[model samples]
Target: MKKFLLSILMGCSLLEAAAQTAFTVNHGPYLQEVTQDGATIVFTTSRKAFSWVELKQHDAPEAEAVKHFNSKDGLKEAWNTFSLVRVEHLKPGTSYDYRIISKEMRSFQPYKVVYGDSIATKWHTFSTIDPQKRGGSFFITSDMHFDAAKLEKLLHAADYRTCDAFFYAGDMTSYIDKFEIPFTSFIDTSVKLFASSVPFEVVRGNHETRGNLARTYSSYFPKKNGKIYGSCLLGDVMVVMLDSGEDKAENHWVYAGLNDYDAYRTEQAEWLKELMNTKEYKKAKYRIVISHFPMVMSQQWKDEKEWVGWEDAIRKFLPVLNKGNVDLLVSGHTHRYFFHEQNVDGNNFPVLEQGESSAVRLELHGGKVQFQVIGVDGKILMEKTISKK
Candidate 1:
């Protein structure tokens, strides 16, 4: 009887151990910073695990897939919940199918490692940006403020699958108090719709700078040069994304002395100066700047005192952008739509201030860029076109 009782207790312990080792994907498997020959795949796991990505050309056989792990020097990234595996050396404008694989690490020591259950996601596909290809379309939206429903509506209204890239201009959430807020507020919705296969670039907004996890933003949306502001060549267009920091001054009481945007803007300005001189920027047929705040606001807000960040942008960034021969500046912050014409309010380029209710689709073809603002009800609210610069 004693032996039988001990056997039952051991069985229960084994069952519990098995249950604890069950692994699953928590969020992401989304594409970010996708370039002509490389892309970063980010995802999180339910438990500490070693993660990797299996990738192959879309038309290739499964047996031809290559496994990629996020590693440095001689060590592979392991014992972590978040996984960021960057796949490189891909062909330009090529379609590739990929999936994430994570194995739970039950225990790890210098001489021994125990692995548990592993998980692999269904295959997803994405196409790398082709710098030489002319005429591609992209969708842009901002200030959803964590309204997943609204974001989904906008994405559907835009028919997002047909676009080469999706740009979240800023403020997808009101604030990110926890790490999960990104996945819960917007990323999860995106993965459900198109993020697993389509590369989405996030431009930082003022509100995103307000939460505790704000510093971790880059970890999720890694960019070139390790900064939020940078330029990417998508198709034939050069898209420059800028980080418009908090709306108030750095020393504002509400910030509790944590702000330093004044200097940050200066740093961006210096970077912009050099970027404009780069061969990539100068050779592009079209250029668009995505800034959360309109550096040079309309005449109506020219004297507004509440926007110190805007003032700083005008003083620091406007001059560099003007000299860069930017064709358009797309921004969202005021929740009101306004199209400022070129040479208006000290801006050499046209500025499109997209409202919260609409998504802007910019199509480049026939030497012109056509802009259509689609509303939540799936109706076109505004349309405009600009010739190549």
Candidate 2:
């Protein structure tokens, strides 16, 4: 009897050991908010663990690699399954190899912390955006609405690998109901295809604002300003991303008094007014604004009742964009494709509304800006070039 009890005890210990060894990466090691001198790397582990990123120039020796972590008040963030490490002071347009390392935390007691086995990912490569470069390309699409298969088809329709970045105008999912919704819907495929190497920029849409996890969206896609709307300079071209909150008014019955997008639009307008005065905005060879909701609607929908959000955007954002001399505005909320000429519906710049089944590849080179709308079937649906304003 004593010998049998000893064997059972030993088996239990072995199982516990095996559990600790099972800790591994669960989701991403994808790039975000990549700029000339910095980038944010985000990923998740299967279990609670402390994580960091180690990187070096692509051709540099491994000995020269440096580690980075998300730190606050001189303390590194740990004991969390989600990891977002920001790396800075990188050279512009330079290539680097990076990997994620995590050490599982077994227990946490005052003065008695226990740690488990560690794991690291194989190296991945990326290049920082260069402000001086005169040419580049990026992919833009929207209204995916949780169709992972459709997202994959759209991505495959373009030469996404050669693009500098990927932009999802919004509605990647129907709603953020669960923690895994983003991964299961679109992010996992993005990381598999090109997001690990190229930056992924997302503009929040109306659908993304629903459900419980919606409030935590920024944790997954952290920006320097902590807001969904911002601007990035890619070479001589400036891309402005605007967050056009929910489609209904703050007091609408559907919102249940939890939204204040009207005020948010006013706030964003203030920021846009200031951005237009900056030298970077004035000097860029081309300026493109991306908003998930189109500032102007077709004549038929102009009088619709639930268009408070659209009306607010036009009243607040359109004036600023007009004065900024923006060359193009790309939007996708209606899921309908149309190209509105300049001065249509009070917008000084042209508007291109991307449909649910199409993606746009925008290329900038040698003082020319051109875009081609490609359908999920890999055929060019429409093509146009914009002359400098």
Candidate 3:
């Protein structure tokens, strides 16, 4: 009888140990919107837990480290899995080693708390954007359409770690039909590539507006000011990210009476015009716009029947961009890659579009912009250097 009781006790102990080890990092520890003074790190754990980031100078002793957390709500929730921890007051152009720590919060109530074993990720290092750099490089790619295998392949091919930041222009997933797909297709792929160290700049594509989950897209990929469009200065380059809306009219039967993109775009235009007048926009030596859809559509879509909802954007945005004196525009929607140099429209900026499953790398600094497109097979499809105009 005594031996049987001991076996039961041992089994229970082993089960408890397994449960403690279950709090693993499912995805991320990916960097987002890194700036001179601050940076955002996002990640997910396998189970409900309270998470925080511990960091110090790359070469500094651990004793001098600080803990950053999304603990505004007290950090006592056991059901907190997705984490968006912002570390502020960081030195620009400096390196730091950081790790994610998750403590299983078993329970939390007014004045009462229960916690379980904790887990910490292996330490990783990241560099902040150099405030005074003469030039820096970044990677751009779009139109994944939920092709995880292709995304994983391209991440390896592009050498994402080498760039100062990474941009996904749009269509990272198809329809975003199911909320989980975006988590699986976009978030998962991004984290695996950069490991919360490289900055990521994401834009919204037409396909991202489809399906029921479309409305909840931002919950997964939150941006500055909760905006889909904004501008930031990376090194000496000013990058403006825009949301082009759906590829069809709001009244289009497919939208099913749910969309106000035209009005939304007009409002964005008003804001953009004001932004262009700001001292920051006017003073930047290099200005670039990253839109999911190209401002100048192809001749094949000239017919009214084939119109894919670009009228609102062109009519509302082109003038502002032209007046803003944007040096270049990077876009990706047509799947087929192409470059337009002041094409058919009365536009004044060049546009570079990436093919499906390809990546564009840009090295911007001084007064010159050099870029190259790499194919899925790791071949350079095109390379060019242009001066700021």
Q: What is the C-alpha RMSD of each candidate to the true structure, in Å?
A: 4.0, 3.7, 3.7
Q: What's the true lDDT of residue 23 in model 3?
A: 69
In candidate 1, what are the lDDT values of residues 177-243, reduced to their tens digit? 8988888878999999889988788998988998888888878887646887888998778999999
Can you give the TM-score per candidate against the true fold? 0.92, 0.93, 0.89
Ranking of all candidate structures by their lDDT, best first: 2, 1, 3
- Residue pairs whose backbone atoms clash in candidate 3: 29-196, 30-196, 31-196
Ten-residue segment with the worst summed lDDT in candidate 1? 295-304
Q: What lDDT does candidate 1 reach at residue 350?
A: 88
Cand. 2 TM to true fold: 0.93
C-alpha lDDT (0 to 100) for residue 6 of candidate 2? 100
In model 1, the runs with Cα more than 4 Å from the true position are: 1-22
lDDT of 1 at 369: 79
Per-model C-alpha lDDT, please?
Answer: 0.88, 0.88, 0.81
Between which residue pairs do clashes occur in model 1?
none
- The collision pairs in model 2 are none
Kindly report which residue stretches of model 3 are placed more than 4 angstroms away from their true locations once superposed: 1-21, 73-78, 109-111, 177-179
